[model samples]
Target: MNDTSEKSSPRPRATILGGGPAGLMAAERLARLADVHVFDSMPSFGRKFLLAGKSGLNITHGEQLEAFLARFGEARTLLEPALRAFPPNAIRDWAEALGIETFEGSSGRIFPVAMKASPLLRAWLARLRESGVSFHARHEWQGWTEDGALRFGTPDGEATFTADVTVLALGGASWPRLGADGSWTPFLSARGVETAPFRPANCGFDIQWSEHLLDRFAGSPLKSISLSFCGRTVKGDFVVTKTGIEGSAVYALSAALRDSLEAGANTVLMLDLAPDRTLSQLASALSAPRGKTSLANHLRKKAGIDGVKAALLREIAGKALLDDPAKLAHAIKNLPLRLDRPRPIAEAISVAGGIALSELDESFMLKKCAGVFAAGEMLDWEAPTGGYLLSACLATGRAAGEGAARWLRRS
Candidate 1:
């Protein structure tokens, strides 16, 4: 008589289909409990993240939670739970725990002391590797196979991965060169995942600048100026691009401006060329005798408006307005610059629309597709730069990873 032995069961595998901060965080969270793997389309993980930190890695904001949550605008309520679970303070603690100590900047933005992403990423990756989380780069996800297995286009050929749980942090369509091309939208949509069309969020707007102004003023910075639109005012510096305007100030108001343009509304932005000067003060100063001096020279001497600011006044309000002191003062107080359109989503810092919040539960697990979770920019939420974007991504990533782990236990 021959004896037969029973075969051992295979270990539960958890796959993350993106290697951005969101995917990496999720993998880290699940590494100890399951066979965790992260896959990406790029040659390496966190390319966009590294690019963001090229200047300085803004890890999170140091502001209070109420003010921080307001940065998310309409998505605030939807993202509230995850963000509460892992707020900015928690982000700082996490970074410090990874041996990358953080410090708050003048604007309350938190950054690693090294001021770059590489050190932090390297430390985080080492921790993940030690914990047994694996990464597979250049494996572009191509949706699902006929048998419902997760399919990807590898260098050799198409490959499939079946897992007990899946997390899709494929990011939004912004910065496609960094690997978030948004090719997964159609795949999920076909499978009954309700998604919103992606639109540019923190992107620049196109202005019909005269060739003369474009030739001389393009790339010039509007320093310490205040921009007002839709009843909100943001004071910062923005650069005058060849096509239009961009920078921290413009990006702050971009969501409103983009939405207004999309609704076929004429968007006019009011710029205070001389924030320090009042209308009456400017009028009195302009009314003073020029003594045969050029109007540009007079304006510069009296109002401290010259260079790009002077050119912008003449470009939008015309030279005729300068002749009348009252009109000139009024125009200086409120220079109306009409925005024609928003720059393409590809050039945006981040996009607004994606998988709708309705498509996912509080746990960030896709309702239409069980055992599958989504995080980061892939979800339908948008925030401005200055660390709000990365904070939300990490928060949601942790929530999704925990959700996946819970779902795996139940299944």
Candidate 2:
């Protein structure tokens, strides 16, 4: 094993793999107490984080603690302690300490005032550097050597390093171009670490749209609509893509839809095209006589449905249904469109599965592997967009760091 420990220093050596939000946060936690080293395969740190914040960096949500914790679904029990330890408010406070001001959107999502991740990341890196944390880019972890030392494949060739403690914050399988490709699975598996097969989450599904619909409204937006699947419904907007639909609303219900398809059940996404108008009101409006107003104009004037909405209605329900007022009103209320399959994981916003929680203890340390801990999207948990994903990752990273610190103290 390579002796990376500094004989001149009293602090123990701590090595963190993956320079994402989770890994960086871990380094920050151990910066002053331990000799910290962070490594990433990518040329720079936070590539995926920067991409996500290109539009707006949603730092966390401003919801109640119970509601926020419930967003994690089944993994809530396992993640509760970490989340409660470092909640959303704590994250805001941490950012403020780094000199980044944040504001809450109308939707209760918190974002940095600068509206981009670069400023926050730059400030964070500066703080880490000031605290004496070392960073190394282009160093991809290649599991362990036969002697159990940490092995990494660097640009210069293979290298080995030993540390008193290690933390793995490698992300789940999504956006391979951004460096999180789930390539660490086999390495952990070889050590008897349990993991769940990854699935596409917060993703769009394919739909066999008619060529006419694609030609006219492929890239159009469906605003002020509600999408329902199973027993749940959400109100938001989604874009009609060349292959299928995607956006906030579609991503909200993607988990259920993906599971149904995986179970070999035929999945259909129900759309309420006109959610604000009542069925009776729409029926009464369509009952009016129209001599030569034209079907499109008549529907538009009567039901306030035009553009892509009108195109979708005609495409799904044939012209025969359009002639019937009651049938047309009902169809508008409950339009059923079949979903073929989910988009590829690379195209998804995030992934669903990773290292199973049962493999780790309360301190986020592996039960079988002493002095090694794991955190971030590499864990077996999934949440929708709207800040839930990032929040849990940051929380888990903090927990892992604290856990590793405790281990170092004991040693």
Candidate 3:
């Protein structure tokens, strides 16, 4: 018994596909008890992560669990375990361990002091390297060889590798330029995995616009506005893009809009240009809007609206409505814009539909592919941005790593 207690640690061997935050986290967790290798198609890893962090990392939110949990929508039940295992607080702590002090904004969205992704990625990658994990960059996964070996098309040429366990952290079909091109679906489907059709999740919708409005207002931002569609209302800024309105606010509501379009009714986004003013109060104030003054001037000066906001009002209710102050005020409060269709998956921030939940075990391992597992956006779940994308990535990566270890241990 004493001799057995002195035995050395058992080192499992694992091969992880993809090298984003999820892949790296898996590699890090596995390296502690296993030999880990991370393969990525991109020239360098974390391109999408870095892109997400370009403005600010928005690592996570500090809101109460109830509110934070609500943001996951239909994904709550599926993501509960992984998220519970490593929640937002855990992410903040992990970042803090890397010397990235995070602070919460008034809205509860958390961000690092430096507010850039590069630094945090640098620290995380350093930790993984220090943990003795190997990284194979520019290595594209091309399904598995007939004999069960992992196949990849590298700069050197096609090559195959095998491991006791394999973790697939391959990202979704968004931002193909960043390398998550969704080319792995067919391969997985061929192996009898019940994969879903990938589509845009947190993306924008196309709104047919008159050429005049498109040309004049395109790219203009309407600040401090609230957009409400269906039962949801998102308060933030939005840009009048040539194709439609887009921004954090619009993208946040894309799933609802996209779903509506699919269900047949054209979805409408009602933009509250002045949510602060009630329609009745606005009507009263506008009942006598600068009598002789032009409507545009009155709208710009009295209502504090001009440019795209004014154009948006006219775009919704029209010039006749604009001339009538009471009508104009009501229109300002409820400027309805029709959404035609969702932007393609290539333009989305994340994707919906993937390896369906029914096809995977609790550990995210594909039931059909015994030694194979999936994590991150590759699985069938989607949440809006604001650090959720990265958080799930880390959480699922860690879960898959733990799962791979367990699988190998059992094998």
Candidate 4:
């Protein structure tokens, strides 16, 4: 016998700045109840995501939680809760719901079946639109106004807006051309929110390569090699760039190397030219060298070290050691190449050092600035490639979205 209709009222507005994966995910979650709006500096959204998928869209890793969690390093503890709640399985499921089928590669890195981000992004945008979410492109966030309103510079002119809650998914300082330029750092810092200086991550380091080696092997790939630094070893292929070495293996240890350089310490990357052969085995093989064969030929035939690998060894161990089998074998097994400095942040894949974790609550909302949440590379956490970065971004975005909804409901 109770017939009562709820009073009509304006829905709470949730604004998500930066239309990357993190911002998009937050908008998706918040659109259920709030008037969600996603703003981006780019012409459209997900430019970096598309670029990442140019090779293949490594969505997430299919490894066990323990191993996958360990990849976050010092931020592992801070990120475990978000990741555990929405782990690899959750990511695959979310993609599937968007009609984007994904599969695990041989390396256990997950990717969409199409292996491109365009289809997935198109489908995602459609879904967000259907969910009552709005998009504003080329509206570059220019920090906040004196009255605490979100300010953006648009093609037409400067615009301002106020939202019940805001989720900042502005990415780090990598790929500035793609829109994540780390311009939001000062905004939070000015509000007494602590932040770490953005630094390169998963990037190349400069080395003193002789002009000869640089010219010959600058673009060559050093395949099936092992690189170790700071007690961490990664077995993968890397390319010899004109400045230094870079690729999967080098990037895996980029954080440690970049940190070392920041601390003003000399850093060395040890490359095992022939990882398959033991040091003793290499010595024994070299000891039985030909009587008149050329040193390069002898190396290629006996130890399978030639081309760029041989050049790298000579670059580090010198030609005199090539005559000494024992020393040459040791050098081949542990060729130490000192790294000068990390490539500029513009060239990094992602970046470390952002809004410090201490500044945000467990829900990813800034404690000092209530109703303001942050996610993605804007936060001070870095993980190597192979999908760790994207997973954390998605998880934290979801957390912020759910938190924003709750905060708005309470208000």
Residue ranges of candidate 4 with Cα displaced over 4 Å: 1-9
- Backbone collision count in every prediction? 0, 0, 0, 0
Which pairs, if any, clash in model 2? none
Checking candidate 3 for backbone clashes, the offending pairs are none
Per-candidate RMSD, Å: 4.0, 1.6, 5.0, 4.9
Q: What ranking emerges by lDDT with the best candidate at the front?
A: 2, 4, 1, 3
Worst 10 residues of 3 by lDDT: 1-10
Please write out the lDDT profile of model 2 over residues 93-184, one tens digit for every residue.
99999999999999999999989999889999999999999998988899998887888887788878778899999999899999999999
In order, the Cα lDDT scores of the candidates are 0.90, 0.92, 0.84, 0.90
Error of 1 at 329 (Å): 1.5
lDDT of 4 at 93: 98
- Across residues 1-411, which tens digit of lDDT does each residue of candidate 3 receive? 001012133566688899988888888778877878899999999999899888798878888877777877887777778888999999999999998999998888999998889989999888888988878898898998778878888877787876778999889899999989889999998988988888898888888888989989899998999999888898998888889877899888888888889899968888899988788877777776386888777777777789988887777787887767777888888888888898889998899988887777888788998988888988888888777888888898888888887888788
By TM-score, the better pick of 3 and 4 is 4
lDDT of 4 by residue, 105-168 (tens): 9999999999999999999999999888889898888888898888888888788878889999
Point out where model 3 deviates above 4 Å: 1-10, 289-291
* Candidate 3: residue 244 lDDT (0-100): 85
Rate residue 382 of model 1 by lDDT.
90
Candidate 2: stretches off by over 4 Å: 1-8
